[model samples]
Target: MTALGTYVKVWLALIALTGLTVTAAGLHLGSLSVLAAILIASVKSSLVLSFFMNLRSEERVFKVMLGVAMATMAVIMLLTFVDVWYR
Candidate 1:
């Protein structure tokens, strides 16, 4: 529990960031709103994954694994969209 205090601080910071993201979404950025939200959400997710999951100090291979998973998902989603739009 030695690092408990640091963990709490990080969580609080993440929460604040999340709040900012939500508030920004409400400001009507038009087409950029969802992009901004996704960007912020990705950052917040990185924080949660690295700290809350204790993956920050993990091996390089683990980082590669996460990247690969993200890439695969992105490719799949984009392909589906392309298929729908090009049909």
Candidate 2:
């Protein structure tokens, strides 16, 4: 298959995953619903990043950049959570 064909497939799958996330929000799952949503979103994001962004075959530098970016965001999230934790 062509690159475009793979892209279309991934895009359609992402759409379905999005619908699932929205559907999940409507259902009651006690305290685990939010966690489930985050997990699915992460998976969907990975699919886009790997296929749409073409990161799966990229060079090591690109992977390093992604790691750095993700780490920075994680640090910021942790800092934010610190305040929430204290509250």
Candidate 3:
């Protein structure tokens, strides 16, 4: 697909994800609601990183770095959750 076509598709996906995020917020799922929102936000961020940021064409090192960063953030989030749960 052309650049414009790809961008349009990503834009549409972002819009749909945004709507889903809003809908998820309205529901009373307690702890699951936070997880759902985080998962949806992660998907949206991944789409933006892969498409809008043109990360697909980036070098392997950059991709690896991004992965490490994401992993680190995940670990931190998990720690926070554990701490909160124990308290």
Candidate 4:
């Protein structure tokens, strides 16, 4: 597909994901609701980073930096969840 087509597809996917996030928020899943939201947000972010940010066409170092940043965020989120679970 062309660049414009690819962008359109990604935009559509983002809109669908946003709708899903809103629907998930309206449900009563307790702690799972937060997890679902986070998962959806992560997917959305990845799509934006890979396409809209043009990361896929960038150098290997940029991808490594992005991975490191994502890993650090995951670690922080895991620690927070662990602390909350014990409380």
Candidate 5:
């Protein structure tokens, strides 16, 4: 498919994900709500990074760096959650 077509598809997917996030926020799922929101947000951010940021065409090193950064942030978030849960 053409670049324009691909962008339009991604834009539509982003909009749909945004709607899902809003719907998820309105639900009363307790602690699971936070996890659900985070998962949705992660997917949205990945789409933005891959398409809007043009990371798909970038070099392997850039992709590796981004993956490492994401992994680090995930670890930090997990640690914070664990600390909170044990307190």
Candidate 6:
């Protein structure tokens, strides 16, 4: 497929994911709600990073740096959640 077509498809997928996020938010899943939202957001962000940001075409070092940054963010989020849960 052409780049425009690919972008259109990605845009549609992102829209669908956004809808899913909204639907998930309306439900009463308690602890799982946050997990569902985070998972959906992660998927959306990855799609944006890979397609819109053109990260797939970048060098390995850039990908590695992004990975490190993502990992650090994940750690911080995890720590925050843990602290909140204990409170």
Which candidate tops TM-score?
1
Per-candidate TM-scores read: 0.85, 0.84, 0.78, 0.78, 0.77, 0.80
lDDT tens string, model 5, 1-87?
237988899999999999998898898888998999999998998899988898888899999998899899999999999999998
Question: In model 3, what is the error at residue 83, expressed in angstroms?
Answer: 5.8
Relative to the true structure, how large is the alpha-carbon lDDT of every model?
0.89, 0.92, 0.92, 0.94, 0.90, 0.94
Per-residue lDDT of candidate 1, residues 26-52 (tens digit): 999999999999998888888888988
lDDT (tens digit, per residue) of candidate 6 on 1-87:
238988999999999999999999999899999999999999999999989888888899989999899899999999999999998
Q: For candidate 4, which ten residues in a row score worst on lDDT?
A: 1-10
Q: Could you tell me which 10 consecutive residues in candidate 3 have the lowest summed lDDT?
A: 1-10
Give the TM-score (vs. native) of candidate 1.
0.85
Better of 3 and 6 by TM-score: 6
- In angstroms, the error of model 3 at 27 is 1.9
The reply for model 5, stretches above 4 Å from the true place, is: 75-87
Compared with the true structure, what per-residue lDDT tens digits does model 4 show for residues 15-79? 99999999999998999999999999989998999899988888999999988998999999999
Model 3: per-residue Cα lDDT over 11-60, one tens digit each: 99999999998999999888999999999998999999989988988889
Collision pairs in model 5 = none
Please report the TM-score between candidate 3 and the true structure: 0.78
Go through the candidates in order and give the clash count of each: 0, 0, 0, 0, 0, 0
Selected candidate, larger lDDT, 5 vs 6: 6
Better model by TM-score: candidate 4 vs candidate 5? 4
